[model samples]
Target chain A: MPRDEFERLDSTWASVTPPAARRMLIAAAAAFSARGYHGTTTRDIAAEAGMSPAAVYIHYRSKEELLFQISRIGHATSLSLLTAVTGDDPVARLASAVRVFASWHAEYRTTARVVQYELSALTPEHLAEVAELRRGIEGAVREMVEAGVAAGAFDVPDVRGATLAVLSLCIDVARWFQPDRGRTPAEIGDLYADLVLRMVGAKAP
Target chain B: MPRDEFERLDSTWASVTPPAARRMLIAAAAAFSARGYHGTTTRDIAAEAGMSPAAVYIHYRSKEELLFQISRIGHATSLSLLTAVTGDDPVARLASAVRVFASWHAEYRTTARVVQYELSALTPEHLAEVAELRRGIEGAVREMVEAGVAAGAFDVPDVRGATLAVLSLCIDVARWFQPDRGRTPAEIGDLYADLVLRMVGAKAP
Candidate 1:
């Protein structure tokens, strides 16, 4: 994508959260992704967000809360995308799902690097919430697989295992996808959509 | 596996590194997996290995070396297993590759978790070395994929992308596999083997 298009794509969370909170979350994701949550102090987050160190507490009660917010929002966005996918053709739904899912991880690599890899940083309560959201995302994929199997459009031995593999393949894109390296988000999405269709034993289109 | 068998399996690394150095590596993997590379101190690793804090530097010069060691060995181990997989049939090769790959991630979850996730902490020089090792592992998978495609055993549009997805699915097993929660390592290996076969459009066995 073009530079402007990339920035526009990145500003997606801006409309969802308040300006200050979003800045904090963005700053937190950068820091956490670079050095990890435990190594990143609230002061560092405040500095990155261009606020006084004490300003962090006014927004998030603790550093973990900042992580929790980032994790929740990222997972919620993914879950919403997965669950909102519609239509009777399971193959199409799975393709669309993998496309956006792969694209999001590539586009928001920074946000996703923390969200997917830094789950250990969250407290128990927050981790449970994030895992539940993850389960929802997995459930959506499972639904698509089951539907496809029922329709004889796809053949999968283990729906749950295949669902996990599908998500895992997409999520790891965040870990390895660099802006300058390899394929664009759209390219990866298209590739993964095809690969996943094959994974489900869909007849060649 | 039985407890003794688990102990024996965990000893896969012991023969390569001396007992004390292996202890430090084991301790470091646990700490890095739990708290991440930045959050984990040499003191924590030493303590985990039941050594005085100063004793850590005797085996490993710095915490980063400990991480590098674990990552290098883990990658090497994975690469060895992947490249050593032999068979005339590419489909069988892919299935065997996924089986052991997924099983290693699940059985050696703690070690695999640190090796795969704590890589960001490596210095540029060390990272390049580790990346080279990783490319070897990826190359092995890609080779099997290419062979499958050549023999008309698999129909994959993007062989490179499909190769990545297969390994990504297996590697993430380290991140999420819980020993107490569900399937054993062999079961997951068998399941992933089947899923990967479907992914490559291999003829059903």
Candidate 2:
């Protein structure tokens, strides 16, 4: 990881007010990523943060609540990143979207793992909340594909299927990314962006 | 799911000796998939199998062992499917490989879930054992990609990266597949086959 990327990952929780709450969220994400959500207890989160177990309750009512916060923030951040992408054309826009979205998963592997894998551990109501955000994420990708197709810049037989494949390819990055091995996140982003353009039948940019 | 597909999923454990042990493995897969390895207990597995808690021990030493068995078997089964694909051309072979491998995740969603997600819970020795099968799976895909490039049937800039994307796209089907919604497993297979060929720069079949 580059120094800037490392610093950016460390500052993921900077927006969370009151350092104590942010600390708990970071601890919970680490625990959940290292062990499955079910395997981590509130005490474990507290211990990881060097705070008393009761201090954890002060910021979050329960472990699941902490998970929900981590998940919501992570999803929102990724969605913003996707929607915020700027490019000169549909092809460039979609490629840029894939580049940033795919790399985010690699750079923020810990939060990405917890966000992607631990959804089933959330309460039904909380899951519903996160699912709405997920819909936004999916919609963002779909729209980019659709725009490229509509602009006659890309050829896609089944837009939904193509969109699914693109998102699936990117989302699985969190599961397998290794910091010490293989390509850097930016390199992955570049590779994926090129491959995704192929899938969508976008002309070479 | 079709009746034949349902039966095929049920027969997944048919090769495991002794109907009693097969039943226990099936039970463990269901439990581990539903509640995750950490949230599930030996008692839960036994209850799901309709046997005493002690009966579980008779079949498998521990819950982690049961997970190991499911992971090992599932990985082996998918690996065989990938390597068994036969076609007159590299394009056809790669398409067949992706089709079956991706659909297997959907058709056998329960086992696939446990197989892909619960590996972390396996003991290190068991995990290493399964990782060998995983390597075989990766090698199978890489070889098919290499064959395509060698035959001038596909244009791939990065063989290793393309191979990773191909396998990643297929393996992730397990995480999002829903039996009651959207496309059938076979339909997904067809869609993915087309998209993957597009990915490798294979001409339309």
Best prediction by lDDT: 2
Give a tens-digit lDDT track for model 2, residues B1-205.
2345435756877888787788888888777766678878899989988999998888788888888888988999999899899776999999999999999888887788778776777889999999899889999999999899999999999999999999889889888888777799998899999888988999655
Fnat across every predicted model, in order = 0.62, 0.64
Query: Taking candidate 1, what TM-score does its chain B reach relative to the real chain B?
Result: 0.93
Candidate 1 residue A192 Cα shift, in angstroms, is: 1.1
Q: Score the docking of each candidate (DockQ).
A: 0.65, 0.68
Docking class of 2: medium
For candidate 1 chain A, the 10 contiguous residues with the lowest summed lDDT are A1-10
Question: CA lDDT of each candidate?
Answer: 0.83, 0.86
Runs of candidate 2 exceeding 4 Å displacement = A1-9, B1-8
Q: In model 1, what are the clashing residue pairs, if there are any?
A: none
Q: Which candidate is the best by TM-score?
A: 2
Worst 10 residues of 2 chain B by lDDT: B1-10
The TM-scores, one per candidate, come to 0.92, 0.94
